[model samples]
Target: MKSPSVVMLRRNLKHIARNPTSVFNAVLMPVIVMLMFVYMIGDAFNVGVNYVDYATPGLLLLAVCYGLGSVAVSVNSDMTKGVINRFKVMDVPRSAVLTGHVVASVLTNLIAVAAIIGVAFALGFNPSASFMQWLEVIGIVVLLGFATGWLTVALGLFAKTPETAGMAAIPLIMLPFFSSAIVPADKMGPGLREFAKYQPFTPIIETLRGLLAGAPAASDVLQALAWLVGIVVVGYLWAFASFTKRA
Candidate 1:
């Protein structure tokens, strides 16, 4: 027998294929931001390192952050349109529905990341890291995406409608700006700078930057992994409880 989660994942991917615009919508803003910052005014924002190197890590993560928008809206739509209820009434495992959304979101965002990187390369953002280094970067990004995607899933379940779910996902989209994504955290005002240093996106972005630059750091990687793990565990518990009790 095929896994319930795999079956549901295929169904959702088909739905995504039919509506390609959703993927574009999620990635558009991040792509625009990357272009604006890297091409339009990259020279204006001086933070010591080459702007492309700095911005690429943050921009890729930003795309993943915004990619949560689609997942949230889709999850909310299913709940509102009786699909989750239909699954409950059937013999399907409850967790499969959320797992399917999560897997699809990660894969979609990974593809979006690849596209973003290619565009970055076109704009002269070449990274000369080893194959394993590139793999590590991908791994970290996917882990962070899983964390954010699952949390958005729970938020979607909590929403009154798909609109609210999209709104709920806005924080993730805004996260990169507050972190060491676009600029170094030390460049901001004291308060905002301190906040940026400790936020979830900062270490993750910094870790990716370090990895891509071929000067790997351990602390940020640990911090990013810790944050991802924490988010996934909490989000999973909240989503499971909410789904079992209410949906």
Candidate 2:
């Protein structure tokens, strides 16, 4: 017999496959932003390298954020529609349902990330990382996605409706803008620069930027991992607590 999580994973994947609009919505905004940055406004800013190269990693983070909104919406849908209650009555593990959503989210968002990268390449984004560095990039991206998946799941469970859950995710989507994603932190004004420097996304983006440039700093990588681990732990606990309370 297939595991409950596996079964639920298939169910979620099928739903996503049928509703192509979700995927399209997730990918569209990030692509437009990348194009705007690379074409209309890129030359205006100087990051010392090709603007495309400096911006791709940050855009990739943006794509991940957009994709997570769907995860929150999907989880909220399951909660509101009584699907989870049905699973509980059938003796399914509650964890399986959340697990399924998180895994499916990571898988779908990865495809979205790949699509964003492809668009970046078309816009002259170039990564100088070695094969090993590329693997590290993939690892970090996956880790970040998984951690945020649980966080979104918790948000979905806590929300009164899907729209509310999506709204809750808006802060996450906007967070990259405050980070060193599009422009360097030093280029920003006083207060904004300090916030951008210390925020969670800054270290993650910096690590990614360094990796793509083939010179990742140990400090940045460690900070990124610490942030990911903390998110995963907190998100997991919060999600289950919310599930127990709500379900």
User: Count of backbone clashes for each model?
Assistant: 0, 0
Weakest 10 consecutive residues of candidate 2 by summed lDDT: 20-29
Off by over 4 Å in 2: none
Among all windows of ten consecutive residues in candidate 1, which has the lowest summed lDDT? 20-29
Q: Candidate 2 lDDT, tens digit per residue, 131-200?
A: 9998999999899888889999999999999999988878887999999999999999999999999999
lDDT of each: 0.86, 0.89
Model 2, residue 122: what's the lDDT?
Answer: 83
Task: State candidate 2's TM-score.
Answer: 0.96
The model with the greatest TM-score is 2
Query: Which tens-of-lDDT digit does each residue in 1-247 have in candidate 1?
Result: 8989999999989887777677676566668788899888899888877788879998988888877877888999999999988898887898899999989988888887887898888888867678999999989988887898889899888888999999998888887889998889998998999999999889989889989988878998889888889999988988888777668
Best by lDDT: 2
Candidate 1 Cα misplacement greater than 4 A, ranges:
none
